[model samples]
Target chain A: MSSLSRTTFASLIFGFSFLYLPLIFTAIFAFSDAELAGVWTHFSLKWFKAILNDEDLLIATFTSIRIAGISATVSIILGTLAAAATMNTPRGKYDGYNFLKRIILLPIMIPEIITGFSILMLFMVIESMFGWPKERGILVVAAGHSVASVAYVYATVSSSLASLDQSMGESAINLGAKPIHVFFHITVPLSWRAIVSGWFLAFILSFDDLVIASFLTGPGTSTLPIVIFSNIRVGVTPTINAFVTVFVVITIILASIVYFRTLCLKGRRKGRSATR
Target chain B: MSKKVVGFFLFITLLIVILQWKVKDDYSGEVVNVYGWYGIIPREIFNDFEKETGIKVRYDFYDNNEMLEAKLLSTNNGYDIVFPSFIPYASRQLLMGIYSKLNRKLIPNIKNIDGIITSKFGANGGDVQFLVPLFWGTIGIAYNKKVVSQLLPGETIDSYDVLFDLSKISKLFPYGVSFPEEYIDILPQTRKFLQLKHGGESVTDFQECFRFLEKVRPYITKFSSTTMISDLLSGDVCIAIGASDNAYRAMRSSKAVDKDIQYTLPKKTGILWIDCLGVPKKAPNKRNAYLLINYLLSPEVAAKITNHSGILVNLPAALPLINAEIVTKKDICQSDPEVLEGLTMGCARAENTRELIKAWSQYKTNTHHTSINKEASK
Candidate 1:
């Protein structure tokens, strides 16, 4: 076992501190009793209690989560299908397949503001023409988020799918299995990890989105970021800090659960192999 | 593996369906959608309105006027009611035909609106028939009393001189002086101050305002609008040019931190800022919007809003019902008739907006003269 050099050690410390110091301070201040976020007084749970009473903030949080969940699900389906279609097709066999690959990645290339604005314009045009979607709301926001995140899901899923051995799927096809059967049994199961990771990525992207959500959100559909951003005009209350602290704690707990579950699964696999 | 995957997806599908159902359940009833500034109106008022009329209020908020304008400009924004500031946003939006002609009959309580604010708004080309100028406040000087007193002994901090006067502001510069982020906040006040000082001839030129600002620009420690309250409370800035409502908030919070924060309407030239309420032209629930607006207009409701939010609502009848703390605080709610009369409402003409924005950005980023001289010499 080799130790890290002094330069590497110092750089690693600097990098971690740079990334985490603000979050650490935010979590610290979340417990402060002072009205001003920057000031530190005594520790208090008043802000945590205040969050429960803040019906608007709670509603916004749920709205954000719902939108993220719906969009992540939609994007995962769309992205997986797009990835399979593009990856399974033999190179240069279809002219449009190459074009499709390039076009699928366009959303990732374009800036989010432009994507939000253009999608908004498209919705307006559709409304004027077809008179459908009568109003922008949660659905419109979810659709907009899916459009922005599907490219990311596609990127993640495709890169992982590309690394898989193509012979497995070919052999399944050779053994008289249908394309659907092969996709479900072989392609999907093998790339399940990538699909799950992609779904999480899309979920986070949609959850953290402010620009696209702002453009598409309508009456009674303000997302969490929109709600928090609006509080800036009047100084942001410490309740938001408490809210964020709670969110961080939940994330850490969830992450640890996943870590231990993976560890347990790995240990079980080792035990099965050893017994065999 | 496939069965587990299928179950996972089914669970997610069920969760989404339940969420969608929950979100849509509230829309089954009659509702009025309001878009306004966050924390301006208390929740109890909305609850009271709901209990009285059985019409639920779906309130959404935006921190800035631009966000509200963006929605209004878009097709079918679905907002039954919106609050836009009078000077630039509501005034400009009115010209774009975004607002519907409010039915005066629906809002009979409109008569309770203060005459002074209405007239002041009207002078700035605000039409009550379209945009109802309801929420109002002043843009003034908010300073740390202890810091300012120590910075300039024997000096009263009642006027803009403490900020605009280069000599006086220079002394406070070390302690830290903050300026408004928006050009509109300070430009009009600067114009008024110059007009009062120079007999209103040479100062009429906007260029003179910029030149005057240039002298004090070097001394400004930071340019901010939203964080002024915390800045004042934290002693980050000894003095800041900010909105009266924010100043009131700072003053209220300052006590908890053991700081003496005071806000003053510039004695010579105070700027009146008004937020107007109106229904978008294509509002889906115009009737409910009218009902909500009228409910808000009632003196008791308006007074409750003012009391809870520190934002002054323009209802003369609500005056007596307002808290003494807000009413007594002359800077927050100026009850003095003479001073109130002198409060000028400033609006940039539609054509001048582009030029004003350009000038403001230039002023914000302009380098110090000495630095410029050094660069030129180099």
Candidate 2:
């Protein structure tokens, strides 16, 4: 039994090391002085300085942030509403609820490149008909990103809704509360954490997207992932390593804050229960 | 919390509207949208162009020719200037009626362009009105001399057999060969190498190219478009068939890290490629596009582009301004016309391209399975 346990432990370590070793190497190389990527001659911070001064990269980063924020927000609102609609409607009352759910989740099923190209075609048709969107710019990119993100948000929020007690909303409605009020006061509050998590997930998906972003990107609207991808294609420069490092740092900070806040909330809930 | 979230959403909506308005206004300015290969042009040139012409240059990049073609065909691509390789795609684009004629009157600097460039394009149905030559280079074998020297003492590295003669070189360094992943770049070289070996066939022969490609498929450890230079520098692959400019750049970069790498033009034949700048049809900023082109053509700007890109430029006036060391490097500066002796320039192969690409794909798939089987047996 001891031997089996030790072997399993060793395999676990091997698996995780295989997964994270590249990321560790990337972080280490971000500070390496070498240009051609093999041996570290000396430690340096010049790559970070180079990243800060790269106007195009900075602009791309800003564009990505803007698109991710807007797309995530749009996903949250639309996903929450869709989840509410499905949860409220009776199976027989809405004859096509399952079909609607599948349609809503279709973006997740379809390959991203196909979705990107299709969205591009859709936007082009809409532009031809209405002449509203003068060009394929940020709004179009945001819409393209939101298409993929909505499914993610919907999946998370709907799962949370499915797990919730059915009688809560019913009891609220029976206690002389309006249906809309019950939805706002009960359904939303209970599912708020899931919605927030879904929003963050959508944000990351839109942020990290390269294929869809490439198709939807137009003049002056190149995103971070697209720029990094093209630059890395030629060669892996130290500046790209620095960019990845910064991205990793940001992700870590965000994750830590969320983790600590959740811990605190849980602790507070425990204390309230103890008092009761 | 809900109210705060709503307010934040409203604020973001307002910000997006403002940004969109600004983007629309940017088009009215003297902005030239230049699409070209990534890392080909230095950023300083764009800054200098903006300073001189007051035309803001927004540069975008693509790795392959197909992407550029797709962009040109798409509605409202908004690119004013596109730098596509002169052969095949440019000519194909011309046939498609997607490109606009250059206003030679606006570009008085056209006179500064070398006659060799203009005449070559003119002979090949590339009118000066349609394309302005940007940079030109050749595709050849890039090798590590230290490794190749031990394999064959006193033998010159000028021939493609340094890569193709697998039994001789592969035993010396197993899996020491790498070819390009792109069919377009590798196919031309394959045709030329096989022609040199098998003695003169049509440049468009699918069976011949595939024969050589399949013969070499097992010897090559990887088909790399992106990581070829790195592999060569690391002494992983002794020989790589790549562009002269890329090979030269890798050699220069390796010097900084104390790695020995060198590039050699094939002794008998090589594929010559020239990338040209042109304005696409219905370009919103044609006037600024012309200004930017003429600016790029100017001797000083052209010299800087040549120096930084490590590729030869066609502006005769820029020649005097180019660094003496750079001009002497045969790979970058093949100014003499005599050097064009056995070089085959890529032309519009629209007829054979589809079939050749298909055959190559099938060959590659077969080779991939064989390689997998060999690995499994090992």
Best by DockQ: 1
lDDT per residue for candidate 2 within B1-378, as digits (tens), equals: 566545555775786676667656666767888777777778888898888778888877676777788888888788889988877788888888888988989988888886766677766667777888778788777888787787777778777776668666665457387777657666666666655443333433545556556666766676676777778777788878777777867776787567788787775667677888889987888999998888888889888977776777878888888888677777556666766645666535577666556655665566443332333346
Q: TM-score each candidate.
A: 0.95, 0.90
Q: Provide per-model DockQ scores.
A: 0.73, 0.41
Candidate 2 residue spans exceeding 4 A from truth:
A1-8, A90-92, A174-179, A272-276, B1-28, B172-175, B183-206, B367-378
The lDDT for every candidate, in the order shown, is 0.87, 0.77
Distance from true location, Cα of B356 in model 2, Å: 0.7
List model 2 lDDT by residue over A1-276, tens digit each: 565788799998899999988888888989988775554668999889998777778877887887888788788889889998887664578778989988898889999999999999998898789985766677789899999899999999999999888888878778899978877877787787788789889989999999998888777677888777777556767788888888889888988998999899999999999999
- Error (Å) of candidate 1 at residue A26 is 0.8
